[model samples]
Target: MRRDELEGAVREALSHQVAVARPLSADPAGQAIRRAKRIRRRRTGAGLALAAVATVLVSTGMAQLGGDPGRQGKPVVVIGDPNPSGRPIPSATVTAAAPTSETPVDVLAGATLIGVSGGRLELPGVGPAERAHLLPSGGWLVVGAPTTAGRSLWVAQHDGLVQVLLAGAGSIVVAPDGRQVAWRDGTGLLVAGVVGTQLIGPVRTPVPGKAEPVRFIGDNVLVRLDPDGPGHTLWRPGVGELTAGSDRSTLNVYGALPDGRLVGQVSTDDPAKTCLAVLDPKRDLKPVLTGCGPELSPDGAGAVSGDGRWLLVNGWVGKTSGSLLVDLRRLGQDLTAVPAGPPVSGEVAWRTESEATYVDGAGKLVQVNVDQVRTGKVAEPVSVPGVRPGDRPVLVTG
Candidate 1:
């Protein structure tokens, strides 16, 4: 009975304490009321916060995988670039092949001109489409615009040589890779040191003191020295001055008359200084005619002289059908042609016109008849020790 009464007294005291917490006690009814209000305020704040979050998600168009309170009538996202019809997607890469084997390739990218007619190069990934050229011999030919090089000219020849410009007729051979190039300057001819962006020459035939045009020929740069004499010479970087090596070089000039006959502006009056002369780069004397002028040698025909002093022509032009024997000399009204000895080397590889290299196996150059290119053993044999150290000879044929 005592225990039960004590329990009842403890419960009554707790109830009394709770009632006084809001009122006068240190724990009063006033404090209890404040506590109750705080609890109610917390519950209300939490419910409002949840309601605000739900409202925000619905208004902002943000969504979760499952539909939420914010989900009204919005559609689900497909997650990729979508085609409503659901068509099959194809790949972007391309594979192409031409229908014909013979196609002229005029434009190219990332290409290298390995020879005169064709070249080798990497195909570009963009721009105009390019097709490879297949030769009759099953060899590959590439045609493209010139490319920048590591001190190399864009042109290469069939003989696997680079074209090097020079000053005179004598060619200046440049070493492979264009590190060194041979050149001539008047009497100064050398096959020695060269480098990137070096002075080729003063661009003068006679070093350009006169007002003459200077141009970069395949193997050399050309300029008229006296403009009157046979002095229009080519200039190269290491080479000082040189002329076209062939006997009919003057006629071979673009501005010259096709028949080796000059009717245009006369450069000089004195025949001694103005006459067509071929200078042996190693020798000091000048010869009458130096190279084979094809246009001037038409079936025993002769070309009129510019100065009206002589007739220039090939000595034995009518003898061979395709052979060219260049012999130019001064002829009086007698019409009797004077013949000179020792033939000049003129043929160059079209692929690499500037390199001073012959594709024949002959160590010593021999003159050929141009008429025989169709059949008469046209390809001459030339060999230059280490230059062509193969059993088969290097060829300088048509």
Candidate 2:
């Protein structure tokens, strides 16, 4: 055969091989491409759906963790002005008062004299005392039994007039700014302001196992231990239940700062061993103060200064139950303890950021400078009349 005939035969063979290797039908090729695209689309959709579900789950978990779901990732709104005009006036300067009488004032009596300045004595209204608190704005919150079956809650004004705020109340708590008040009656939690009182709660509320006290967390928000047990529930009125935290330890939260920091005690199985800790409720339950001992009162009863810089703690010093001033800035890292004189039966009042008032061991109302306390110097106890020996005084200042 000729060269041209051989080449023609080879070309025909190559064409036949190419045809055999090619796809059998255009329909099959189009179908394969379409099927690959559908698989890619399905995979993409599935991934997006999984991400969305995960986001929802995360949000739900955060809400259960005591975060305000509506305000998540946002700043909280704090009510009331920290500083107003006409504050820190000389007439309001309680530390300047001097005790004059050793006469025992029966605080349990309907009316009791709280303090004396110059020659004048400050006497608040009288009643069967249930509980008393000092308002941050400068006054007294006196709750007592007006009748055998009912209760009376009054705010003793700066002018010596007692304002009847509530009747048939069981518990009361003043707001951080002292502009509002909260009380528990037969119905539930009732908040009162210049506007008026409104009930916020389960009408037929179950009785708390212990005296469940109402505490203000924000201007319009408050927290109470779940009457059922150790956990806590936050209430924001119109906002409904905002956040909640389960009790992971035996720490009892006494008070919370405006920023959501908690001041409480961490109690061990042994009653004698307890420590006061400042905790961040929003974070894991670890305390900012690791050192726990007798320095912190077992009752965990302490007061934070309005500036949030100082903490006045009531605890036993040796055999005597006394009060100590702690600087919050150095908490957990260093212990800056300031002696608040001898222990009194009642609460200590802060007259200024650096000065506080308490009843001395002799039953005399005494005022001391916290800075002097830090220097290991005990200031002379200025005597105030009307407060008797063994009488517990609830100190309040603006």
Candidate 3:
């Protein structure tokens, strides 16, 4: 909708609404006549003005539903259950996401958003679109709508003299710590990420002569199942192929366990089989757990499995697809569940374990609690303006 039309809608809605006014009759006859006239006149004028304001708001979808501008610009997108365990989330005046940092940027729950900062990015395949939120980490996030293209794919703009990613971005990531990002682009994988503005370089994960899927381990590293070589090649940032697995076909590199130990599996379908094992370049592979996949924390301090425990087969529904969270305290265990929502491809945000938030099935903002995890009761969804999507939701974690 155009800006003017939004203004008109707001005006129309406010025009006929009643206002809190002092009792009209509690006055002397002469004064009452004057007061009544003044009230009517004021109401008429106010109504018209409000209508104008409403029109602006509705057309542009810029609804300042709460606090001032500063608070409205809270930069972070998280997908998970709402922490209904206790305190209320701070009221925010959310806005549509934009290319710049100051503007009120918004994205639909289903849509993914990528922002790049620090420098410019050059995509050989596509051109940059309109102004959207870009991070300062020298990485640009591209919102790839989940179609065949993949759900809301985020890519770092180009960087370096011969840039590979996040180069078109304006803002840079303040602190990436040591995180690696990857996604499937057809058969090969594009891996480029950061540790707070530090470019981790991108690779066209070698698939030997016959291409296969590529997986990210951590840092600026990736594991490619060398078609020619015997097993998986453990690739690291700037230091290619640190180690290779014994059996080339089975080794699938997931990533480094926070303890600096590598974890992975031999892709399989049998539930009775253990899928997880330690891939230390030093020692031989050892079985640790199964029925769960390896995942690391945002800070790179830990790893988790989506399912803390193996599913009991007798009554178990088909294995859950979203993910399994493993308990760090126990070696061969996993978390019950991490809340089964669609996998949003872009930046994901999560505050605590129990309280999680994500854009729901209908593209409305949903806050889920542990109760929702047990019963699958999603909380009332909230809407952020300018964000428009119906299939997937993205958490903007800047």
Best by TM-score: 2
Q: What is the C-alpha RMSD of each candidate to the true structure, in Å?
A: 37.2, 29.5, 20.6
lDDT of candidate 3 over 236-319, digit per residue (tens)? 545553344454433444444556555555444543433445556434333344434343211111122222222111111245
Question: Could you tell me the lDDT of residue 186 within candidate 1?
Answer: 27
What stretches of model 1 exceed 4 Å from their correct place? Answer: 1-119, 122-206, 209-223, 226-230, 233-278, 282-285, 288-398
The candidate that achieves the highest lDDT relative to the unseen native structure: 2
In order of lDDT, best first, we have: 2, 3, 1
Judged by lDDT relative to the true structure, which candidate is superior, 1 or 2? 2
| lDDT score at residue 113, model 1, on the 0-100 scale | 17
- How high is each candidate's TM-score? 0.24, 0.57, 0.40
Pick the winner on lDDT between candidates 1 and 3.
Answer: 3
Worst 10 residues of 1 by lDDT: 76-85
Model 1 Cα lDDT, one tens digit per residue, 339-361: 32122222222222111222222
- How many clashes in each structure? 67, 8, 86
Clashes of 3: 86
Query: What's the candidate order when arranged by decreasing TM-score?
Result: 2, 3, 1
Residue 273 error, candidate 3, Å: 5.7
Native-referenced Cα lDDT, model 2:
0.45
